[model samples]
Target: MTATEFIKKVFFFEVLQGLALTFKHMVSPAVTRQYPTEKREPVPGSRGLHALVRDTETGKEKCVGCGLCAAMCPSQCIHIYTSEGEDHKKVVDRYEIEVLRCVFCALCVEACPFGAVALSEVFEYSGYTREEFYYTKEMLLENWDKNMAGEKGRIYFEKFWRPKTVDFGAPALVKTEERKTV
Candidate 1:
């Protein structure tokens, strides 16, 4: 062995260096937050939980029972059942979500043409039983009302969600005669 390497091994240089690092870290300000007392705010547009949007005019959920959300879901966590109402309109009988199985990919929100579903900024939900995680239509609507009710919901849709197709600016078309051949 080299003399320097033998000296380092005998003097416990590696252990001393590790101890120095530990002490340095101990003296430094703590980066860890006291989670229970000082909970960190969730980032805007962060996918946390699911919610169904309400139509202001109708005062009802905007979901058309089209099943597009169910079809688009990568995890197949969403389920919608439709039935004809008294007026013979197709109404959503049930809109159930298996929260435990959802990947929070937000594909369902993107797939909705009616702007019915949204991912809320609520990340603090917990349950002891699987049944607690199974959300019904009422529960989703309640979430929308409680968390993303007014201006916040509108802002979320405008800022985070994809823009409407009509809002896109199309390029101007050029005449065929004006095009030069390469």
Candidate 2:
């Protein structure tokens, strides 16, 4: 190719093209809001974190200790022990999720047959210690309440909730109290 032609393609169009596109987005409506002050709704089914749902009807832990979520977890951040319960269902003994290792893949949520687990929109969890990063059932439930607050986020979580093949689904409440032996 001629020198001028190459310059136009490389410097003028090709290299500068990316900058132009970026500039366009800068002028267009922003997709992100400033953190804390301005929060945007999470896309439905956002795999932000792992949470065992609380059964609304019973106001208790919905997790039946099925191990489906644990089986589906790719990161293996989930740790659950099971025991016999009132209905002979496997009860969760100590449901612990290592937040530092969680990938937010939504696989566990989808794997739950009873819709007892989910990926919550509460993406704000951070920690200075490994101990702090490991979330217990209580911590997960608190995140659920915080994230599920307000109508907009709640609606967004509801609509976007869809993980397939027992790998993803919708957001679930961590409100239930009946959990494992813990």
What lDDT does candidate 2 reach at residue 4? 87
TM-score of each: 0.82, 0.61
1-182 in candidate 1: lDDT tens per residue? 99999999999999999999999999999999999899987766789899998877898998889898899999999989999988889999899999999999999888887678999999889989999999999999999999998988876775556435313245335354433220
Model 1 pairs in collision:
none
Top-lDDT candidate index? 1
For candidate 1, report its TM-score: 0.82
Model 1, residue 181: displacement in angstroms?
46
Residue 62 error for model 2, in Å? 1.1
State the C-alpha lDDT per candidate.
Answer: 0.85, 0.67
In candidate 2, which residue ranges exceed 4 Å CA deviation? 1-40, 149-182
The predictions' CA RMSDs to the true structure, in order, are 8.7, 10.1
* Residue 103 in candidate 1, Cα distance off native in Å: 1.4
